[model samples]
Target: MNPASRLAQISFTAGPAALLAGWFLLRPIHGEAEPGPWWTAGHLAWLAGFAMFGLMIFAMRGLAGPVRGGRRAAVEAATVVALLGVAANLAQLAIALHAGFTASDGEQMRALLSQARAYPGIELVVYTPGAQLFFFAVLAMAAVLALLRRVTTVSAGVTAAGVVLLGVATLQEGAGTALAAVGMAVMWLGTLLLGRGPSGDGLPATTPTRA
Candidate 1:
């Protein structure tokens, strides 16, 4: 493939892999209220993951191929929503990184986190609904691509399942990180399969007409 296509494939594969790595790094400190080396490293990985996801969004649009009217609009809208979610995720990770850097102990870390959460809309936007949009958008895009026959149903379903698990993983504590890791692994697998290109692989058999 061309350089841009190659880059997209790389980002698609690496984004969730980074996320899984972050989850693994953070698992040991799941309930720990303290910020330290592990915390810094984990959040840094997450930051990179979300940033990569931002690029992956546009890559997904490219995968959707050229379209007009509603199809194009839907793809574009999904892209925007995914990007917004990625931005929110990045912001959250940034806050976590800052807390890791500034806080000295568990108590201090809790206090810092509490104070940050106290900011209006931060909880809902960065923590909940906003960050969640990314998953929703991804699932939607997968579904759209499936409907367009750009990707296999299995790929779309697997991606949707992974997204759901990742969402649920966020709500738990001790085992949540493990669940997240599994989810990321599943997502990586789906994306990897999706990257196989057309011809009964993952993508369509013929090159999509570029928009």
Candidate 2:
């Protein structure tokens, strides 16, 4: 198998899983009563997913190198994309853990609400768009890396286009949309790229050297 191909496999396995695992997280709401198990459950699920995603990224790092010339670019590209994804999960983990301390029970919620009323400092950190954007950007990059490893022409083209487009979105709405778009576009392009390869004569220029 080609080194690039192996990296592709690694990204495909871990990248997608990481993205899925860290999909959506909950944010703090000011002046709004968040007093319910149902609302809290969603947050818990998202946090769990983020943890699994972190593990997935750790797994992907082991798939690097030994790639042929052409494959090197793709592997590097994928690495860039995946690293951002890991960062996103780390941010979420921080937020989730902090919440545990503050959201212990009705008393805590009420107390935090009072603190927000008094100072509003918590609101700033809890609702900062920057953290959200950073997280999603990483997630999107993971998708891009995974997709990059797959097919090139159609799939790679599509994924690249997606990366740029999602990047734009990330700049706007935050990282969540960007990462979602990254995952979608990367997967689409990768599968497309995998469908075709180069001829031995160097016509299509498909495939890396066999492992």
Candidate 3:
């Protein structure tokens, strides 16, 4: 594979791995009263993961090749939505990191976070439905690629399952974090499989060869 394709593959694999690592790091203190070193590290990992995810989305778009009409439009739309989701996620993480750094104690951190959440649309956009859009968009793009034969149905379905598990993980607390980690692992495997060409080679199916 070329440098660009190699980079995309690395990002695709690393993004979810980072998320899983973050979840594991945060799991021990899932309900801790105060933000501490673990919390800061976890948030940092998530920030990096989401940033990589943004790159992964664009790489998937490129994998869709030079198709026109609805196919191209679908990939492009998914790419935009996924990037928006990534932005929202990053914003939320940044807020959390800032709160952790500024607050002297758990109560102060909570207050700071609450104050930030109280901002108009911040709760909705960065916390819930808005941030979740990224996973949905990624699943949509995976399905589109499957339809285009750019990726296998199994890979797309596994990815969709991972996304669903992650959504479910958000609804729980202690054990849910573990679930989220598993979900990220699943996503990593799915993307790894998706990145392979038709011959089961490691390179992306749409990767171009040199003359």
RMSD of each: 2.6, 8.6, 3.3
lDDT (0 to 1) per candidate = 0.80, 0.43, 0.82
Prediction 2 TM-score vs. true: 0.41
Please write out the lDDT profile of model 1 over residues 1-211, one tens digit for every residue.
Answer: 6786667778878898888888778777773656888888888888998888887888778878877777788899999999989999999888888888899888898899989989999999998889889999999988887777677788788888888887778767432466767888998887766665444443333454434
State which candidate has the highest TM-score: 3
lDDT by residue (1-211, candidate 2, tens digit) is 5765444444433443344333332233321334454335444555554454444343333332245554455555545544555455455445544544567665676665555435544334434443344344433444433444422345435545644555566567654554554654564344233233211111133234432
TM-score of each prediction: 0.89, 0.41, 0.91
Off by over 4 Å in 2: 1-65, 68-81, 104-150, 161-165, 174-211
Q: Candidates 1 and 3: which is better by TM-score?
A: 3
For model 3, residues 1-211, the per-residue Cα lDDT tens digits are: 7887788878878888888878777776774536888889888988999998988888888778778788878889999999999999999999999999999999999999999999999999998878888998999999998887777888888888888887778666432366777788888888777766344566555643221
**Candidates by lDDT, descending order:** 3, 1, 2
Model 2 C-alpha lDDT versus the unseen true structure: 0.43
The regions of model 1 sitting more than 4 angstroms off are 172-175, 200-211
lDDT of 3 at 90: 97
